[model samples]
Target: MLRLQSALGIFALLLLAFALAENRRAVSLRQAAIGLVATFATAILLMKVPVVARAFGAINDAVGAISAASRAGSSFVFGYVGGGALPFDLKVPGADFILAFQALPIVLVMSVLTTLLFYWRVLPPIVRGMAWLLERTLGVGGAVGLSTAANIFLGMVEAPLFVRPYLSQMSRSELFLVMTGGMAGIAGTVLVLYATLLAPLIPDAAAHFVIASVLGAPAAILVSLIMVPETSVRRTGGTLEDPEMEVASTMDAIVKGTGAGIELLINIVAMLLVLVALVYLVNAMLGLLPNVGGAAISLQRLLGLVMAPVCWLMGLPWDQAVTAGSLMGTKTVLNELIAYVDFSKLPADALDPRSRLIMLYAMCGFANFASLGIMIGGLGVMAPERREEINALGLKSIVSGTLTTCLMGAVVGVLS
Candidate 1:
């Protein structure tokens, strides 16, 4: 039953993308087919290949090491609340764990490490290699290829910075591909943060988040191709340029990266507080409404009814659809952080292992309305001339990104 739903879900999702196509006739079957093949192949390579699986395991261990290192820094500043030995005995195990002091600092450490790696020329080669493979696989130019490949590790706004010179030259379809790529993947900084959050709930979570990002890239391309097929000729005039400025030294890179991460930390903190509070506020308002079948009509319940079918189609059992749907809906509407937090708090029996795994893939993206604004604002500054065009495609990119991840979930459902 799970396999049948997952297999059928792929076609259903493709058809939905087709139905949303700007020019249905322009959608290329060859591109979409290659994308599907690439996504599955990437997943199999990362998850099933023994050598690669062992490497992924090593990476997960490294994530643990990185977390411990961050806690060392935090422990000095914030003491035991950050992760040090407790001065007082705890009545409840791990009740002392604090998100601000412990989990969020991973962003700071990762930001510095990513900058050092890039500044030392370690990341450029790997990014360039990924770009080359993406170009060969997806038939994209250097600009789109670099942007999409980088989005696997970099944030949506930061990834496109590498291809800033070519932004004005990309076709609408190619431009949409960049936007969709950002929507479908999470940044490495947050990857560690999330992996830390879910490490207890899901084994080797850093590897899973990494695999989710890998799976998202090709799926983003396929969905973007379906929605806004290439109608204009792209002008690829030169080599890919990394717009990252040169730092004086590794110290400079660490200082600058920490500064950049501070901004992200503040934004994440503020946004989560506001959005989560608003969700509860709205839920309280909703509490006044009449009950349905003896169940309270909260936002989660409403979203579950709407998105359960979507999750079900992604191969979750019918009994768990509402639960999975709530997480998906929260990720789409609020953000993945909140959704994943709620998922972590679920009882052991709330979702089976398969359903939990599927939800992880489905919710691994920046597809909410919030991201649309950020993309528009960031791209507007990066290429002011393309502001109108960016505005035009902003809303549709959300749907493109959301469907892309859902397709990924369905693919994982089949393989898992």
Candidate 2:
């Protein structure tokens, strides 16, 4: 009975997308069916099948090893202050320190490793295979397909570069998909860091993150197609050409990758500082208001009020819905970083196991206000002519991206 209710909820969300579609008449039922089935099958396989579960367990073990390696580098450079082993008795847990030093360094290391893998031609075949899968399943042009697949591994800005040449020629729907795909999944650089933050709160954290990204790819397609159906007839059905960014050699790739990682690291730290401070200020003001339920009203409470309905729709039990909703609200308004930070602090008894798992899939994405700005700026500079279009679609992309994550959460809710 619960599964049936969850399935109905998922259908309603899809219908909501259809109602908001730019060209309702252009919505392709065939494409939508394919995407939905593929997404469902992939999620079930990754999260449930015994053989696949074992593989994900191995992946989780690998992520643990990588986290340790990243900490080794962080310790060597920043000492005990950055989660490194030290002889002194600070007696503080590693999670207590500034995230920039302790967590963001993982991003840098992952970036370098990702670059090396690409330089050695290790990632291209896999990327192409995934792209091929999406293309064959959705009947999308190669360029759109490739960019969507690349988003699973690359950041929003970097993923579109693979299909840069096709951007100008892409139809409105294709462009929408490109942007939607970028926002729907996170970059590889920070996947491990997120997995680590979530490790204590959820089991198989690394595997869940991986599954969310993979499953979210198809969900994004389905959501994008429904919300912004392909009405334009122009199709750039060309095959993907390997995009070459200038890296003189292996050493150069490492240097460039590190530099890029530093830029991302600084950006994350700055955004978190400002956004967190803003949230504090707002909460302080809100504290002046009358208490609710014998406790002073807070930003968290307000967000919970706003998102609780959506969470309930996603099939969360009413008791856990508000807490999970607050997390989703935080992710949308502030960013997933602070959202994850807050989620890690939730008391074990505050939520049941099922709701906790649902939130895991929900919060895994780059869809937030800050990301919208970054996408506009990054993709704007890449293709100056499309800047207006990028700006125009920015808000809609956020909606589609948020819906994609919720859609994934809904699927998990049904299956669980």
User: Which stretches of candidate 1 lie above 4 Å from their native place?
Assistant: 53-133, 236-288, 291-300
Work out the TM-score per prediction.
0.75, 0.76
Candidate 2 lDDT by residue in tens digits, 74-161:
8888888777765666674444455567655775766677677667766556545655665667867666777787677566766775
Tens-digit lDDT string for candidate 1 (250-317): 89988987886676566656644665577678888999999987977787677668889989999998
lDDT of each: 0.79, 0.76
TM-score of 2: 0.76
Residue 413 in candidate 2 has what lDDT?
88
* Candidate 2 runs further than 4 Å off: 53-133, 234-236, 239-300
Kindly give the stretch of ten consecutive residues in candidate 2 with the minimal lDDT sum. 234-243
Q: Positional deviation of 370 in candidate 2, in angstroms?
A: 2.3
Give one clash count per candidate, in the order shown: 0, 0
